[model samples]
Target: MSEGVVARLRQRLRHQADLGEVLAGGWTGLGPSELAVRPVYLEGSGTVPLGELFDLRGEPAGRIRFEGDLARADRLAAGLAEGEVIVEGSVGAQAGLGMAGGTLRIQGSAGPLAGAAGPAARRGMTGGELIIRGSAGAETGARMRRGLLAIGGQAEAYAGHAMIAGTILIFGDAGPDVGLWSKRGSVVALGAIEIPATYRYACTYRPAHLGLTLTRLRARYGLPVKKRHFAGRYHRYSGDLADLGKGEILEWTAE
Candidate 1:
């Protein structure tokens, strides 16, 4: 494998920029010079070459790193079907919209709809891993079909709204209306959360899958997982009785 590509911010962004197209599968094979010319939609400015905003370096190797404050950058890794993407700082909305494969790791917080479906799309994050080491905004995994979404900090309301099938793990406080209209998905909350009224209480049990999943998060992602988490019991709630009623919310409880 070749050394991966690196794109460092050249200057402070005055406007929100859309970087969705910069890291698609085809662009991963291009050299730095060629990749630099990729289009980035800048607010008010219309469009500009990525090279004008970032200093591109390194070689293509199916991995890419973005270094700098990108809090105003949206869609940093949308539709990523392959390769790995690492963002060293915060990002704007739609960080992993419609991603089908690969991994998108964000070192800081993300805006609303971080791993949700696009405006025109029917599904969100069919496959892939979205790891947010910080808090996330509202509707973090809305309409998701399949994949793993891990949030290390607080999540706003409707964190898993309308989820079809997938897994969402929130390590901090989850906001209101979690798992509102989920069909068949799992929302695991390690912190305080209010179960939606549409869900019904299920028996408490130590799910075998929870232990394995927490182990992976600790070993691979370095998430803070204590022994209590692995051995704790979870309160399972089945809902959204308004929809398929197969979705569940797993709230961690001290045994």
Candidate 2:
């Protein structure tokens, strides 16, 4: 699989850049020139062409890769509905907000709300996969309606807060209030997790799903999957009973 278009940072951005809907639907068919003309909202400056920020290269294809320091670039892949998008380094807030389909892979930490909904929107990420290979900020998957968010490092507070449905798999320690008020969803914690009082201890067993999910992560995504992860027993806790009580937290226990 080739990296369709490579967008390299032209300069160190001082302000937050909102690449909203720039790589959404119909982007895979666009060339570098076409995609560069899309709108990107800057913090102090209003709307500006994407070409003004990044140097776009490569032919039109089904994937795109962004390089350089984008720590101040927010909404990098917002509203993405198809194809693949890759970020070489850390991203600012709302990395994959409201994404409906396709894959968004971040090789570094995410700011916040990786697959969560916007403030005004009721739903987030109807479908898709978001892979954050580093630590994530608060509310990474808050109000997520559907999709998969795999965090390779520690997640801050409210990692999966208020998730309606979907999966949030954290390979490292999870922060406080995880899965808080989540009606339905799965928060798979491979490390230590903060279980709220609203959650009730369920059982300790090996879930069948973890085996398959881990295999794919190791084979396909090349995540650091240990043999103990598949052989370990998990402590299941059903939580956010304060809401509908359908969500659960699967914390990997001793091997």
Candidate 3:
């Protein structure tokens, strides 16, 4: 696929606008015409329509660029199964809820449960990558089954609650209870972090995969990826003994 569609936001939203179903599959087989015709809920009750929210144009090859501030836009990439979606600014809650596959990038901050499952849902972020260039609200990657999530800015409390399997990288300070109930996921902390008592210190060493992951985040998203973050020593802790105990927390150490 080629560069898909570009949707430029027209105005600040007074109600929720769901961009979930639109980019669900990452424009796999869809074209510009189909994409423009995709549905999106609008503010003030009844669905206003996606065309009303942004100026949609270009081909649909499974890649999309969203322009303008989407801070008020909720579910920007919910249930995505394929393609790549980029947001120029912040986004509202449940940004990538129940996302099965694909790549979703938010250039700015995000609200609560950024890549978590929806209400009554069993899993979150079943697959794919969700990148947050700025801060993320509470429970950023809760209940994720698989995929990668990188937060360039601070992450709020309970950032990776009950994650099944995947990786979450936080370049900035992480709040308390960052990975309380995670089952089997890796949380790499480049900034300050306090590991839960349930987690035991394993060792302080350089994890090769982390370097590759952080490097990608830096080069691709323009994150503040210093040399230290990639080559630095990290304090590895394994925990969530309450669950599978396969989860890990890598806290970067100054030494």
Candidate 4:
């Protein structure tokens, strides 16, 4: 695979950036000026240009990779309608906000709202796969309408708040208030989790979906996949009593 222009530059924003507008320029064909142009934010103004910050290579080939640590990068993939975005290290808040399609993979931890909807938006992650190899901050999948969010590590509170439909898998212990006000969604907790009071305990059973989901997480992303996690029994609790009450929390149980 050929490298893109970002592989050749270091963006130290003279101002803030609107990644949405920056990436809008079709990645297929571009010159140095077009590729070097990225939006950044100033004190009170909007974003600035990429050339002012980073050094600016190839072109947008529908796939991009951030090689260095981007702990300060915010909205790394906001409103991304297509393509594959890879973050080599940790990311700031709203890492994949309002993504409609494509794949976002983070090798390290992600700040709050990793796959959450944008502010005032009605939905989040309408369609896509967000793989966080490390832990995720609070509201990791807030207001998710659809898509798959897999956290190989732990997740903070309010993980699936107000989810309409989707699947969230947490390999580590989930914090308090994990899923609240969800209409219809599945929260698969392979580790310890205390189901919300609104959720009523359903019969213990084995879900077939985990097998397919976990397999991809392991083979595609290099996440640890144990035999137990695949064939494990889960205690299903369904609710959101205050809402439509169609969502569920599946806590992996010892058979």
TM-score winner = 2
CA shift of 205, model 2, Å: 0.8
Residue range 1-255, candidate 1, lDDT tens digits: 655998999988889999998876666677689989888999999889999999989998888889999999999888888888899999999999989888899999999998899999888889999999999999999999999999999999999899999999999999999999999999999999999999999889998998988889889888888898988899999999999999999999997
lDDT of 2 by residue, 219-253 (tens): 86777789889888999899789999999999998
Please give the range of 10 consecutive residues that has the lowest summed lDDT in model 2.
Answer: 19-28
**What is the lDDT, from 0 to 100, of the residue 155 in candidate 4?**
94
Number of the top-ranking candidate, with lDDT as the measure = 1
Q: How do the predictions measure up, each by TM-score?
A: 0.97, 0.97, 0.93, 0.89
User: Which ranges of candidate 1 are over 4 A from the true structure?
Assistant: 1-3
Error of 3 at 235 (Å): 0.6
Candidate 3: where are CA atoms >4 Å away?
Answer: none
TM-score, cand. 4 vs. native: 0.89
TM-score, predicted candidate 3 vs. hidden true structure: 0.93
The global C-alpha lDDT for each of the candidates, from Candidate 1 onward, is 0.91, 0.90, 0.85, 0.78
Error of 4 at 118 (Å): 1.5
Q: Who is ahead in TM-score, 3 or 4?
A: 3
After TM-score superposition, the amount by which residue 16's alpha carbon in candidate 4 deviates from its true location, in angstroms, is 7.0
lDDT of 4 by residue, 199-252 (tens): 999889988887888888888888877889877788999978779999999999
lDDT of 2: 0.90
